[model samples]
Target chain A: MKKFAIGFYVAVTIALMIWGYYQAIYVAPDEQTMHEAQRIFYYHVPSAMVAFLFFAISLIGSIGFLSFRRNRPDWAQASDAWALAGAEVGVVFCTVVLITGPLWGRRAWGIWWTWDARLTTTLVLWLIYVSYLLLRRFAAGPQVQTLAAVLGIFGALDVPIVYMSNRWWRTQHPAPVFGGGDDSGIKDPTMLAAFGWNVLAWLAWGLLILGLRYAVERQHQKYAAQEAQEALNEVA
Target chain B: MTSALWTHLVKDLRIEWRSREAINSMLFFALLVVVLFSLAFDPRGAFSQEIAGGVLCVATMFASVSALNQAWAREIRHQVLDAQRMAPTSGAELFLAKVLANFLFVSIVQLLLAPVFLVFYNLRVEGNAWLLAVVLPLGTWALVANGTFFAALSIRTRNRELLLPLILFPIFMPALLAMVLATTSILTGDNDPTLWIKLLAGYDIIFTTVSLLLFDVVLHAE
Candidate 1:
């Protein structure tokens, strides 16, 4: 039953993705001024949204792991699993955002990038999680979870500072405002519907992967525990 | 304030005083970085004022990592970390003392480098000169505090030296921006650096408190 349900969900997610792509590429009218380049928005913005949502999930999981470690070891393990999964998935989506944004910018803005508040913050966010992933890859011992949780907290704390620090530059030539009119421009009915579908589709896909990643991490943790138990038995 | 913390600080300070190994090494590495940037960027005239801030901060960052990589190495030798775990003292104090010791060493290097920097870059403090004093130390504290905590966090990892900067640099990005911009603003007299200074202070306080609070968890991890 479980396998059937997961398979069903995967099939539905694929269908949603195809439908979303159709809506984005064909149904959504070309945006004025930039035309085809604006289509990147459907994929780029939704991926960014899903990425932020997952990173927030990672932060909550880190906190949950730390608080629950003493009283609820099993719960702590589950939380750490979520933490790792969220960070991993978030980084994947964030990488998409970083790449697609530049492609769109090169066409739309006539330049590849600018050191604006949003762009810089997104870049820093990507760097922090990439390093978080590196830490997981390189670190060892029984305390990996504990150390990762601490770094997770620190990384999340810096996001706001990173955002504001760029703002502090207060340079005479202001950062080219990418999103200055972006929020309200979505009110056009056709674009809104297409955008809505793409957002839903990407989020569904991201969550499915996140869930799979979580389950895999949990299984790995259990396998390692069993291996350690076997080693202890041999020593005994 | 605590005597235990003072004892840890004093012990580190005394040991460092004897060898001056970290100091000498950081000083030379930082000097090389300065010379390299001078050759590469050709910090000439007005442009020098703009980039010197970034160069100094990068130099400080690279030099400090060498010290930070070994911040906990001494404790790890001969099972000294295990002994610390057995003691009743708070892990936060030990973390703080290490930060302080490293901060002092980095600051001393900065102080020594200032004269050389002035000659090399032809620096003239266009804004308040006293503010550099405030800005430099605040920035140094932010770097050292996070570096020490992270050094301890990475101590058990396989690639200890390599992992420290990989993890530390990203988290250190905002402070690096504040330090570089604040220093540049002061140098150029472009605008008030009070905002960046405030941002650095807040970053220092928030990260320091969190590091202290979390050090116990990291120390007792099993």
Candidate 2:
């Protein structure tokens, strides 16, 4: 029954993804200024949004693991899984934002990259999480969870500083083009619809992958625990 | 300082003073970086002032990694970590002491490197000379405090040395930017570095507090 439900969810997510692609590529009007290259913004902005969301989720999970590690070992293990899954999936989406941003910027700004507020913060965010993943890979034993949790909190703490420092640099940064929080540059209704659909679709897709990653981590943890138990039994 | 912190700090200083190994290597490594950067970037006139801040910060960063790699190795060996835990002291004391010890060593290296750096870059402090005192130590504390914590985190890994910088540099980026920019402004007298200086101080406070709160958790992890 669970398999059937997950399979159905995956199918629906794939359908939403195709619909989103159609909305972005065919339904949205061509941008007078940037033309087809502007379409990359549909993917780029949503990916950035989703990436930040998952990273936040990962931060919360890390906190959960740290708080629960002693009394609620099982809960801690599950939280660690969510933490890893969020970071892994978040990195995947952030990578998309980094690449697609450059491609779009090359057409829109006549340059491949610049050390502007948006670009610099996103790049540093990607770097911080990538190092988080690397620490997970390199650190050994049961302590890996503990250390990675500590690093997670550290990485999250750096993001605001990264954003603030770049803004203070006083360089000529072009203002962010999309979803700048309160004052969005996106004005057209058609463009807004396409962007909305893409955000929904990409978010759905990211969550699906995040769930799978979490499940895999849980399975691995269980197997490792069982192996340890069997080794103790052998000693007995 | 608390007795435990003071004790740890004094012990680290004595051990380091005996051999001076970390200081010697850090000074030589930093000197090499300055010369090589000069060779590569050709620090001439105003350009020297422009690049010197970045060069000095990067030099300190690279030189500190070797010392940080050894920061926890001694504790983990011969069951020293376990023994330390049995003592009636919080791990935060040990962590702060280590950070303090490492901070002093790196500053000594920076002081020694100042003459060599000035000569190689043909540099002058254009902004505020007194601020160099403020900027360099704040930057060093940021690097060593985080470096010591992350170093402990990576000690049991296979490539413990390689892992330290890989983890440190990325989170260290914003601080690096502030340090480099502040130093550049001081040297070039182009921009007001008050903002960057504030940013560095804030960064140090936040990261240091978090590190202290979490140190014992890391120290006792299975």
Q: Taking the tens digit of each residue's C-alpha lDDT, what string does model 1 give over A27-116? A: 999878889998998998899999999999999999999999999999999999999999999999999999998898888767898887
Clashing pairs in 2: none
The residue pairs in collision within model 1 are none
**Candidate 1 lDDT, B68-116, residue by residue in tens:** 8876888899998999888899998888888889999999999999999
| Number of clashes recorded per candidate | 0, 0
Docking class of 2: high
lDDT of 1 at A140: 88
TM-score of 2: 0.97
Instruction: Write one digit per residue (lDDT tens) for candidate 2, span B1-222.
Output: 499999899999999989898899999999999889988988788888889999999999999999988878878779887898888889999999999999999999999999988888788887889999999999999999999998987886766888999999999999999999999998888888898899999999999999999999888888
Task: Evaluate all candidate structures by whole-model CA lDDT and list the values in order.
Answer: 0.91, 0.91
